[model samples]
Target: MSQYVEQGYTAFADHYGSSEIIFGQFRRSRQNTQRIVGATKWCVFRPTNPTRVVVEAAVQERLDRMQTDCIDLLQFHWQDYNDKGYLTALRHLQDLQQEGRITTLGLCNFDAIRTDEICCQLGPGSIVSNQVQFSLIDTRPLHGMADVCQRHNVRLLTYGTLCGGFLADQWLGQPEPDAYSGRLTPSQRKYLDMIVKAWGDWTLFQSLLVVLRQIGDRHGGVSIANVATRWVLDYPCVGAVIIGARLGVSEHRGDNSRVFTFQLTQEDNAAIDAVLEQSNGRHLITAIGDCGAEYR
Candidate 1:
């Protein structure tokens, strides 16, 4: 984010995990977002503990460090699905909203099943969005995630749309990743390797890249990353794709922005699937594991 600030892009960081764990450079990040993005807040996470006061005070302490009167986006990072209290958290969040401390509410890493439960439990207010992984490589959200958001009137803010920078021109025609390319963590590499196999092997991915290159040609130049993002945008209720900013590295501001310019044709969409449909079904839900579960 410091590098993002240097590059003059508005830098807002999402804070997740337990209240006791520090997520980001809270104070400085808040100041930077405010300066660059017009009004911004340091995002705060919901706690695992059921004590409403502890969670409320934790959020308040984050607000105090941010030097902001209100948080712009506060998200429950995950639902305690088998827990003693989900409403206990929501009631306090509703309280915070009524108190004007939190301007917007969101959920992260939650699937459609739990989203329905949240809507049924709390019946809605201030829930502007839900964050999920939606990429060509990971299509679990399309199965039911999109439908639930439509029902609840909640939007999806996505991550992993670019698959940690693998969906790019740089990777096209490259050697199949070796054992030590740093392309993915060892475990993640195993998972994604299975994903590639599902997408019909290296020979087929190269063909897809050929199609992407042809499509990119029509737009003067576009990244496969853009096509991957376009696939996500086609789904209902997707508000934005939170492309990760590798903070000290150079920026792809232009590449990232071009995603909005070109539209994909039915043929283009079919071309992407032509490769995928013929392939074996590794079914990433099982191969790649659940949301945040792989990391665990």
Candidate 2:
């Protein structure tokens, strides 16, 4: 946490259960001199009536857990679109925000249509950002989310940008692993399904890795992961790419920092587009649905 602060990373995203640990680390880092923006999610998967009391308690719970008076950002996630309770929840969250309990409000895994609806109903600037799955493999955001976000002034905080590390050099020439192989992490299994089922076959994925490697080589031998991340960051609407880290177990800060040092040239983009044009990327919007439809 101190090292990341030193590197000018002030924003930290976490879930409710683990938010306090991150907040504690941020509080201790650099004697609290640096400004820390802690963002956490409140996932309501089940149906519920979001009364004022209900919403207040939920926000207060986060405040108590993080030991903070006000939340830097609170991102809400809803599972069932049929249920209108999410709007009620967001209204109360907005109320809390106006009361100064929340600094900013955002959404998690929301589709473009609903995001537009929320922003329109809540009035412009009510929603600041939306966290969604976006990468070279999953370009659903480009289908409509990007346009909606641009129209509403909402930034995209993207995850799955590395496809759970499948975009890295270690997997460049590796054979497809069994999903049932207990060795793979949960994220690996999830993204592996997207690759073999929704995105393309393993052979096509290897082609992508090869092109990424070639591009990285052009950029002074940066890793395939660097090129992959740079591609996502290059998008205009992308505010930040949320890369997963194992913390003390392993860190890629050095390699990740390389993404900012170089830019992809026209030839590099053309080479990558050649491989992507042959894959199922365009069809994924239909197969998997937009933005967060897979979860629904």
Candidate 3:
């Protein structure tokens, strides 16, 4: 945490764990010298009535867990679109925001339709961001979410930008790993399925790695992961890319920092698009449903 703060990274997102542990470590590391932006998610997967009391309690729980009077950003995640309780929850959250309990409100894994509807119902600036899966392999956001975000001024916090590390140089010329093998991490399994069944086959994915590698070489031998991240960050609607890291176990602070050193050229984009044009990138919106459809 101290190293991250030293590197000028202030934003931290937490969910489904001991937020107090993380928040306390952050505070101690920061030493109150720099502002730490803490973002957390409240996921309501099951159908339930979100009464005023229920919603307020939920917000208060997060505040208490984080040891803060107000949450920097509270992202809501709803599993079922059939239920209208999410709207009620958001309304309560908005009321809490008005009362200064939350600085900003956002959504998690919401499809473009709901995102548009919520923004319209809540009015402009009610929602500030949406977290979703977006990468060269999964370009579902481009189908509709990007347009809705642009219309409503909602930035996208993208995950899967590195395709579970498959976009790295280590996988450049490697053969596909067995899905059932115990070696693959959970994220690797999920994204590997997306690549083979939804996005493209292994051969096609190798082609993408080749293109990314070439682009990396052109940009002063940056890693393939750097090129992949740079592609997602280049999008106008993307506010940040959420790259998973194992704190103390492994870190990519130096490699990731290189993503900001250079911009992809029109030629670089063309090369990437050429490979993407042959894949099922466009059909993923329907194949996997919308941005958060997989979870639903």
Best by lDDT: 3
Q: How close is candidate 3 to the true structure, as a TM-score?
A: 0.97
Report the poorest 10 consecutive residues by lDDT, candidate 1: 36-45
Tens digits of per-residue lDDT for model 1 on 113-214?
A: 777778767775546678777776667676667778888898888887776666678778887776476755554475456456644476766676677777
Report clashes for each candidate as comma-separated counts: 0, 0, 0
- lDDT of each residue in 186-207, candidate 2, tens digit only: 9999999999988889999999
Error of 2 at 37 (Å): 1.4
Q: Put the candidates in lDDT order, highest first.
A: 3, 2, 1
Return whichever of 1 and 2 wins on lDDT.
Answer: 2
Off by over 4 Å in 3: none
Q: How much lDDT does each candidate structure score?
A: 0.66, 0.89, 0.90
State the lDDT of candidate 3 residue by residue for 37-101, as single tens digits.
88999899888799999899988988878878888999999898999888989999999999999
Worst 10 residues of 3 by lDDT: 24-33
| lDDT agreement of model 1 with the native | 0.66
Best by TM-score, which number?
A: 3
